[model samples]
Target: MSEKKGSLSINSENIFPIIKKWLYSDHDIFFRELVSNGCDAITKLKKLEMMGEAEIADDEEFKIQILANPKEKTLTFIDNGLGMTADEVDEYINQIAFSGAEAFLEQYKDKTSEDQIIGHFGLGFYSAFMVADRVTIETLSYKKDAKAVLWDCEDGMDFTMSDSDKADRGTKITLYLNDDSVEFANIFKAKEILDKYCSFMPVEIFVSDPSAEPEYQTIMEEELTDKDTVIEHIVEPAKTEEKEKEDGTKETVEVEPEKKKVKILKRPVSISDTTPLWTKHPNECTEEEYREFYHKVFLDYKEPLFWIHLNMDYPFNLKGILYFPKINTEYESIEGTIKLYNNQVFIADNIKEVIPEFLMLLKGVIDCPDLPLNVSRSALQNDGFVKKISDYITKKVADKLSGMCKTDKEEYEKYWDDISPFIKFGCLKDTKFCEKMSDYVLFKNLDDKYLTFKECLEENKDKHENTIFYTNDPVQQSQYVNMFKAEGIDAVVLKDAIDQPFISQLEQKNENVKFVRIDADLNDSFTEEISEDELKDATEKLTETFKKALNRDQLDVKVQKIKDEKVSSMITVSEESRRMQDMMKMYGMSGMDPAMFGGSGETLVLNANNALVKYILANPEGENTDIMCKQLYDLAVISHTPLNPESMTAFIERSNKILEILSEK
Candidate 1:
């Protein structure tokens, strides 16, 4: 190799400093950049071979080898790819922001099919300065007349070029670590970086460490234990060892000796599956293969319920696999791992704005070659294309859900409870998604069956018209659920916290449909109206007694003839007011208890048909009447919510005293 000195064609000397200081948020990204360059180099060579410009052996394997030396504090990426000659190195290495891949693609567009040539800005090589004091590249071009070249650059645009006899037709990049970034030179750290960024790369990557022990592979072979010992029997199952039968009749073969097996160990480490499941045809992939790939990627032991394999080339080139993980609880830690990739190079997992907020609750991998990336390939650039990608992801998820609900409803119903929270969250956040999912939205009724919004209305039309009664807490509202079930009214279960806002969205979507909580208002409370004389004679006295007994002016008590004579009374709270109280509780609004919303306690309904109300009405003012009214009010409060410690103790003592009197009789 001949040697020379030169400067990279950057306008200013501050470019390298800018790249090191502000381009990348994390220093470890420098390793990813360099490895990506190595992959690009290999991809370029393959393209050249495809164009018939160079000869490739039939069995030539394409791979990248990572070599690290802790003593030297150097990390090297060696690839058997297309290399560069002296002039080529001088032009590309001594240039800034000049893309060689772009030029090569332009030159060969008419001759060869396209490949995923990653380096578009050509500044990926300079990222080494972020962690290294110096960088060197040794390359030999695929050109027959090209000479091997050596290029060296310090922490600036100034670099040195030389000629050498590197026989390999590829490039080797070695970075000499700086004092501040020596951690990268560690063997384990280097391997970890490779695994994160290059594990699913299109090229096989092998890490070489001289200090590492040999890795082994175990192989088992069956063999005969002893031929002459008159053992039970052994046969070569691989190549059927048969014995002749003395009898004339056709007979099956018999084994000659007992069988034994030997184990053999072999060692070779290539730490990548270059061809991942996402890169293959959806029809070619089996369910097992998809699950195994998902297990390998996320390390989540729980099997995914279903997956959406997105392979689209039309509007943009996007390939990904989105898995609907088994989310057991609504409040379970929902940290979705969506690994984003640019040309199969790891970008970042937390690209929130690019991925819809709802889809952020899923685990998956997305590789978009055409995604506009910053210099570090970590931050995504804002553009219409990015917005399109986000919308497309939302569309794909909606489509998958729609397909599931239509094709396999029995199986889909099983996942509705687990997946409904995510869908409801999406609807609350995205209007388009809400519109798309309206038909596919499945609501479970009291009969343990699922139905659509229209179906719910149609099925319950005779009992409740245009009104959808739902329960937030199945346990707390089970009493009301039973009451409604007796009247042939099926209430949908809206158990998730997100359902707080989702009901409003559903109502707005269908103005004719009105959603009501089962505990919101009793049906009989509005069914009957009292005459003027009845209010003066019995209802007014009843209301006054309830007000006096509860000892709270905020309690608004109403008299109604409830349907169930077995019930003493029931409590009903306004749905709008309750939702407001729930929202205030979430924010921890100062000095606000959910029990006392809008400076008022729960609305107490006095059942006119109950026997206890008639006795309380007969003696509305006496101390015994007061005690009975207090107990009745307390019982209603207990059913609706928990009573205070003091109130509960008093109630228990009074109940025991009454029980002791009943035992005396």
Candidate 2:
């Protein structure tokens, strides 16, 4: 144990052990803390020069060098940056909560990194005690006639500082590795740690070389004249044939030869890339550069479908690159792979909170210094800055998509299939994002051409009375689509599962704009001049017959008459009811409540001009009337519009039996 000196306190003895044992998981982080302290020293020197307190040295190269030796089981960190005086070291190291780095930074706030201080807390320097059994620091201050000081600490809170006859402009920390932490003294392991955690540091970091050279050369063996190399070759003799046995059988045998073996040469592996693409500016980065970075980070051979570069300063500082990977299948294999990085060091496996839920489909690097990192750099705390960064990233993505849509429609549509899910999810979950995304989102028409909501509405304004008609299931509702086509009104295909709720919310936000299903009656005019009394009368009479024909006990039905004359008897469900069913399904509720289903019943409109419905109304006992009624009702049910499947099947069977009787005649 070493003796405690001036300003040494007993409080550190109790807390320092707890910090070493529980504060961090890896003992190697001590190197990072020590290196950070070295950078802080360099920053302090630069600050003094900027403040006119010291003369600035020309051609000074600021760097931190790390040395490790496996044979000796020792590691050393040296910096040509700055040094500390005896009094400064006592105040910073001997006393807890008195941070020399923080004080230096505050005193030189006017200087930048080239002339500004770096570190804020002195606790980082003490981290060396976690891995080293004995740690020593030799430093020489920049002040004129300053004496060199040496500080030594063993496995306790006590430390000793004394005058040294060393000549240096900065500090050097030598650590004697403990038996359990011998790996830290390995050159290869130390290099890996520095590359992963300190690759993009402001100051250049140097570590021992861990690679060896391979060469091919001619062989020499005593000029081929040694006694062991005598020029005499021996040959094996031939074997004789076997003799006949007493059983009157002759046999011959041969010996097996030994196999020859070939040797293969092994190559060395290098794990670090000094330059990562994210550190470069967006303009300087080519598409190939981005792709290479993606492959390096994710190890995926396939190229990204699209990318968004994020660079923002205020409201908050944030920087990153997000990529949308191609989703070739429905297996959801490419979700939640986006990595979160702080100062180029990986912080988390998946950045769910930093990026919107919708953007989880993207895979790339998000490096934000503003993000709060725990000691291990494994998790991030949720704070105001994190939220601000998330919002900024979302905006950047939206801006990229919108810009692509405006510049090149064809290219935008090509990538839309891959990015649509992310966009839809963003709109559904984030209200602010939804408002910004509405203008750029697109819909695919029956012809497979992409159309924006505003564009579709504008083109069909005169024909549809400003109503946007769409269908959820195109295959099941082919009849409705044909009806809309015959009336010359274009309807969008809302095939995505999220479309129903998204549109419902969109309708509520906008006025005079309606999203009607294709199966909805076209004649239910959006135009003026149809009296309310006339609509009420038509609805009452039709509702009465529809109830009787469709069997109101098992099915709920309503009727409404509209203006356009294309076809008859179309079934349409209310947007509210559809939204509720979707919500119930999302929550995994198999048994739904009747009251919660909403009172919006399905409306079945009959075209008064259609010959089948006209014949049924004129002669309620007509033979073909029942068959036509059952077929129409079944069609409505299959179209996902609403009809009782059981009652419709029974009506169909009875109609079939009646047809059989007519055939017998």
Worst 10 residues of 1 by lDDT: 224-233
| Per-model TM-score on C-alpha atoms | 0.84, 0.62
On the 0 to 100 scale, the lDDT of residue 595 in model 2 is 47
lDDT of 2 by residue, 72-141 (tens): 7778889876687887777776664464534542443333222122333445666777787788888888
Q: Kindly report the root-mean-square deviation of model 2 from the true structure over all alpha carbons.
A: 11.3
Q: Candidate 1: which stretches are off by over 4 Å? A: 99-120, 211-266, 350-354, 525-532, 535-539, 593-601, 621-627, 644-661
RMSD of each: 7.9, 11.3
In lDDT terms, how accurate is model 2?
0.67
Clashing pairs in 2: 102-120, 112-116, 523-562, 523-563, 523-564, 524-562
